[model samples]
Target: MSLLQVSGLTRRFGGLVAVDGVEFNVAEGEIVGLLGPNGSGKTTVLNLLSGALAPDGGSIRFGEHAIHGLAAHRIARLGLARTFQLVRPLGSMDCRDNVIAGLAFGAERRWGSAAQREADDLLARVGLEGRGHAMPGELTYIDQKRLELARALALRPRLLLLDEWLAGLNPTELLEGIKLVQSLRQQGMAILLVEHVMDAIRSLCDRCLVMSAGKRIAIGLPGDVLSDPDVVRAYLGDDHA
Candidate 1:
């Protein structure tokens, strides 16, 4: 069975149907990309899967358990953790503290010491070596994002959801972020990424899914999906395709 499964998932925001019966499966250790233009329901899908918003219809299964209506904390405890588009580092804490908070709080097997050590290692891996004591305001934007990735890893999540983790970074930061995420996949983590940056998605994602007007329009290999006429027209216009 797929490690993460969503069948006929739907979510409505009053007059708008943000996610319209989207169904997909993510297997263990796979890196899947969720791509779409603004208001295409990519982030909405991540939010629903991560329990920040409950689904209006259908179901989600992480492993063998039903998770559609579980509370955020409850879902996290079930081996799922997520990173947000906007980094939410504790304003008053240092980088290490922010990551430590994730280890202590997110759903996962208890391993305080191991989690802290793992967090530190992850920081180093993401090129933030020895800057763990710096606060969010003190670090550069890239470092702040690196801390966010470390924080999520502290949960040792089986399925990790990342929403635009590279949105604001420059070219150099974007490259590093891709490497970080790809490295996570190598560590046997199943990842769901909602990304606007096509270059990153093309390079890091094993498979790509496109959404438009709150519905999935295409899903396939990155190269095939990127070149699809429908996907191109949705965001890049016909001439670009």
Candidate 2:
């Protein structure tokens, strides 16, 4: 069965339809990509899945339960977690403390000392091993991204919704980011990554869903979807795709 399922998801703000009749599924242990142009509604879809926004019409199923209208923290308790496009680590808190914050405020929202052990492990998993006491402001841009991943990992989610995790990193950071996500897949967690970086999508995601104008345009393997002229045009321009 699919680990996460979204069907007929629609959201509207006045006359603007941010997401319209979109349907997709993420299987267990797979890394799936949601790709689209700017203002194409990718982030909005993630927001709905993360329960940050309610859908105008649709159903979201994690495992076998319906979670469309659950509170954001409720959704997290069900093993659904996400990271934002912006890395907002606490400047005063050290790396390990920042990760522990996820347990305090993330899905379950009732974590105690036991979650602290998990927090330490998450730091190592995201390549911040032994850097637990370092302040967020003291870290490099790449380390901040790693810290973000660690924070999300601290939630112990079965399915992760990553919103543009690779947006501002350098080439080296991007490569390392691929390794980070790939390791998640190896550990049997399913990820639905909504990203604009086609290079990362091609390398990391097993399948791709291309969206444009708030609708799904294509769904298939990375190479196949990336080669589609419509997807090309969506990324580059009418003349380029």
Candidate 1 local lDDT, 163-237, one digit each (tens):
888888889888878888888898899999998888988888889988998899999999999889999899888
TM-score of each: 0.93, 0.93
- In model 1, which regions exceed 4 Å deviation? 108-118, 238-241
Q: In model 2, how large is the Cα lDDT of residue 2?
A: 91
What residue pairs clash in candidate 2, if any at all? Answer: 76-107, 232-241, 233-241
lDDT against the true structure, each candidate = 0.86, 0.88
Global lDDT of model 2: 0.88
The TM-score of candidate 1 is 0.93
